[model samples]
Target: MSRLRPVVAAAFLGLWFLSLPALAQQEQMPPPTVGVVTLQPQSVPRILTLPGRAVAESEAAIRPRVTGLVTEILYEPGTALEIGAPMFRIDPTTYEANLKSAQAQVTSAQAALTQARTSFSRTERLLGSGTTQAQVDESRAALEQAEAALQSAEAALTLAQSELDWTTVTSPIAGMASVAAVSVGDLVTAGQADPLATVTQLDPIDVDMYEPSARMLALRDDIGDGRLQLNETLQATLTLETGETYAATGELVAPGFTVSTSTGAVDTRFRFDNPRRLILPGMFLRGQIDLGTTEAFLVTQNAATRSKIGQLTAWVVRDGKATQVELTDDGTWQNHWIVTDGLEPGDTLIVDNFAALSEGATVTTVPVTLDENGVVREQPAPEAAAETAPAAE
Candidate 1:
């Protein structure tokens, strides 16, 4: 009986140890080390991307008016030129000689005309006193012939001057000129070859893009209702083919006078500058035009999760437990929701533990770092650590 009592007593002590709260506390449990974030409202920039091409606001074709052998090319490719600068010389010596001969002919014609006039005057005076009628008629005919000869010579002299001027081809516009088609010493003819060079106006450049016709109507309505200002200086930025931002801002310009039926898009143009002249004409670029801005709740994508159906969602800690939210729209900015339907301001979301978390699990919250674009700046969780930690007994 005494032995039975010790056994019963030992069993009672074991049961008491198991029932104590301290024993429960001694059991190993999952750690609460997880990243968390709270939803917030802040102003964000709304952006849109469209394909565009850089175009010079103005351009001129450097062409000659008359046919000649290209004697010299003045401006090389990739050189800035001033207005009226001589770009090419087409053997001006020949044109100069022609001008001298035409001038000589004009002088000879003038001398002949003066002699004829003097002779005709003397004859008319004699006839008035008692000269024959045939002599009066002959004098008149000689005077008329001299005047016609003078007129012909004068016309030839004008032609020679024009031809001389055409010998030196000059730039019509001030800009960066490039020789696109020809070289020096080539025999160029009228309408045979294109311009020897092209001068593109680069100070004020144009960005041409197409927006849907419906958007145009909507924009017009917004402007009329004071939602948008038509003349407002909306900011524009450009991204080159390499995705680098251009160092210039553009101002919105007027739309094209016509719409394209085939494309259903209105041609939109913006004016900017190429201070460095790095932006070449007809190069494709990506642009972002600022629409109106608004405030929105944002959270980090690290705190986000996706369902089996590829839906994006987030785990938010509320009342000391992890709560899941299924985001209805796109989310990302400042590492959070740029646009969302499920999250509200002040809700705390977990950013670290994705695999170890369930819908109703509890976790400790921490401050999350996010950039201006709403990307999570926090260090990403290690997959190996997360995977191994779950297997710990």
Candidate 2:
């Protein structure tokens, strides 16, 4: 029995020793797979994004000068109208009768003046032939009174003609118009506060946007140094929230002289040729203005992480080990970072598996591509980037 017990104990010891190897193997296994990126320098755009609103280049409110019931509406919404074209027809019968009465009065005054002139001529001859002076004077006074009456009648006739024309509401300017208020047969009183329609010149429209004052100052410096083009119009495209592109190129108008106190931004104007009038006034649009060449740093966005102190940080790989780097404040990239500090050239940055990573940890390195959402993308090497740069002529 003693010999059997010794053999059993030896077998148990052997099994325990075998299990130790497996435990060590599990501990030595690598961490989970993650994405990574490298730090490098490339040209980045120094663009300032801001909100903007569209407005018409020229607009006129169509209102009536005289009061009457609307007889007809000759214009429709989105219709193009010419200058002096009749848009609304008011009741003109009343105005027409007034004009006719004024004309008759003018005729009656002219006949009285003719009779007075004939009497004056006779009186003048009698005075020269030794007729009574009192009679000649009285005849001269009657002629003068008749002349004043004729002038008053002519003034009245002109006023009546003007009122008749007001019954036909004509467009003051030539352009595309919008139906604001009223339809056919709607009573439209003259001198009423409300407008009948609104006309806008849509071929060339304006967009007003605001940008930070700091960005504007920097842009001005870039322009002066030829790093950016200034006072020159650039082709711009507007993207609506619905992802539609407005089919027009915009020109940069003048920059605003006043800066906003609340936001510290300056209003800037842009002019776009909207020949089709597809863009409506008061619509919001996203504008892209390309200010040529700027000095910027380029690094993968994955490499940038935020520190507990509310600062952006990155895990820069140095000598095959991870190191924490706090990126500078002035940083931006298309999907990367134009870091100001905490990074140098030839540094490899980790883009994935950062939560469990610790300082000085050794990691396997790999190149990573950034997707549109700035997430790490493991991809094969790009042939385009591998091509040698062309020599400067």
Candidate 3:
């Protein structure tokens, strides 16, 4: 019995030693489950978003044409006024008195001129009837002097009339008027540094935006290379400061033909209809311009990560292993990265379980589905999952 016990114990010890290697192997990690998407080039609109400011199409400063006391303000401040509309009324009493004085001088000069002409005619008749030549010459000189005096007087009268007409200040344009600079009873003058008021055209306002010159050149090159196609009518979309899109679209009026020396950017202007007056001059806004359509590869943000040095990278799955790849992204489109390089069509991109993956690590890839909104969702890979499952004893 003692000999049989030793033999059985020896057999049990050998079996336990063999099972240790199998248990150690079982503790090793299996392939990590990962969600992946197949790369497919898509046609997407190339859009450039930039900051801009709304500006009035035309602006004019109102100043008094004559020096006088401001008697009354004719138009309401901040209200729309048409061209030739009265804006202010200066006291016209002084201007009227000046005009009357000028008229009196002109009347006196007319009487003098009539007298001179009569004398000259009588002298000429007397000279023909044997009167002295000296008398005729004196009458002719007197007529000339009188005519010159009348011309001077007429000019003064015209000046006075103009001054009188300028007493009533009018708007030079059709637009909204600013507040009055001078109140009633205040004496204002022509050629003053300060303006009486300001008018600004609001409807069909303009927006000025600046874009980097380098970026614009690059876009043009791409278009020339046939990599991108631009629309015939270049229109832009506006976003207000409150993040709401404006109802009316704007057309690009003046493209940046010249680059700014200081800012290294080009100035572009867009015109938008402002019937509701929602967009005001000097208001800051955002603008999106569609450059054209281009072929690009779209990947979810989760599938890509930024390195510490700001370089973008992603994991591509092939032959049941994940390979790390550096990527160059043009920009973001609908919450996804628009990759320009570092990936090709038919490459499997790891969308989820990226934190647990490394280069050359085996991964169990599941297909990812995207909805119309570009939202990524995981789908069960039944065949792949079943094949990778543990077999029954």
Candidate 4:
């Protein structure tokens, strides 16, 4: 029994020394450091981002007006061209020959009319002396017939000239020319089903956007009730598919004349300066339009989380303990959640290190400050550290 007592004492001392490290570790373990931001009511512009497409202000199909062999494509594909710029040239040999023939016929008809007029004058002068009335009438009829023939020849010449002009296909509008459908030496017809090329106006391009009619109507109601103040000069900004914003801004042209019955959306058109031609037709884009300013409580998206049930929640620190609060997020605005409810101004919102937090979990908050760009940066929370030390001890 004496030997057992010594051994037990040694084991007890060993256990006590082994537990000291754990006790020290617990004392040194600080409450989980979390980044926190105080909620602030701010006047933020209510901008609506909508999907849209870029469309050309004008488009023209380049088609030949005279049937002939395509001689040449004068303009390069994907090149900007001016109005009346030559796009394609058809074989004008036939048209030129026809024009010459029509001109010769006009000359011949003029000679005949001149001879008929001379005979008519002679017959009229001799009518009082020896010429019969029938002869005079016949001479007058020949002159009238010759005049009609001359007029027909002149009309044919005019038509031939017009057709000759059509042999050189030109762009009716100033725009970028598309690739030639019919290459050089390809046979093309007048007013054919296929066009030789296409031209699309790119500068001052149009962007087509659609908004749900219900939302549009609600906006109008808000404006009427003075709940929302719309910008007098409504401006829009575009974001491309690559997530880069277009440099030039845009203006709202007008809403579509008719609402789509099937889609329940109203089409709206916006005009944007596209001097760089960065935006092409049929490009999918997003447009952010400023709908005016409103007062709202704003919270960073990093502080908010969505549950499996689609309820948005955030951890708010109150009395040095983290509490889960249900947030009514209207939507995201500039990387922040626009909270309409569930939070108030001056509430501390936990941003970082709150992911694994539970309701009423003790926390040491590091207060953060937002810069001019709205980026949150951590600040020293001396008071928070002091408050949490007693609990940790």
Give each model's clash number: 10, 3, 0, 0
Q: What clash pairs does model 4 have?
A: none
How many residue-pair clashes does candidate 1 contain? 10
Our model 1 lands, by Cα RMSD against the true structure, at 11.0
Model 4, range 1-393, lDDT digits (tens) per residue? 988999999999999999999999988887787878877788767787888999999999987889999988898998999999998889999999999999999999999999999999999999979999999999999999999999999999999999999998999999998888887789998889888889999998999888888888877886787756788888889999999999988998986777889988788899999999999999999998888976677877766789999999888999999999998765568778777679877999887776658788788877787664567676657897687777655
- Stronger candidate by TM-score (1 vs 3): 3
C-alpha lDDT of candidate 2 relative to the true structure: 0.78
List the lowest-lDDT window of 10 residues for candidate 3: 371-380
> How far does residue 319 in candidate 4 sit from its true spot (Å)?
8.4
Top-TM-score structure, candidate number: 3
lDDT by residue (211-317, candidate 2, tens digit) is 78898887677678765544344545677768787777778878699999898988888999887777778988887766554554566665666767878877867
Using lDDT as the measure, the top candidate is 3
Error of 2 at 11 (Å): 17
Lowest lDDT block of 10, candidate 1: 329-338
- TM-scores for all candidates? 0.60, 0.65, 0.76, 0.68
For all candidates in order, the CA lDDT equals: 0.76, 0.78, 0.89, 0.87
- Candidate 3: stretches off by over 4 Å: 1-29, 97-161, 379-393
Alpha carbon lDDT at 127, candidate 2: 86
Candidate 2 residue runs with Cα over 4 Å from true position: 1-38, 93-161, 173-180, 183-189, 200-204, 213-231, 260-264, 275-278, 306-310, 328-334, 338-342, 352-356, 367-393
Candidate 3 per-residue lDDT, tens place, 1-393, comes to 988999999999999999998998877858888877899888888888888999999988999989989999999998999999999999999999999999999999999999999999988998968778999999999999999999999999999999999999998888999988889999998878899999999998999988999988888888888878887788888999999999988998898889889999898999999988999999999998877788889988867889899999999987889999999887777778888789988999987876788889889988888765666777757997899899999
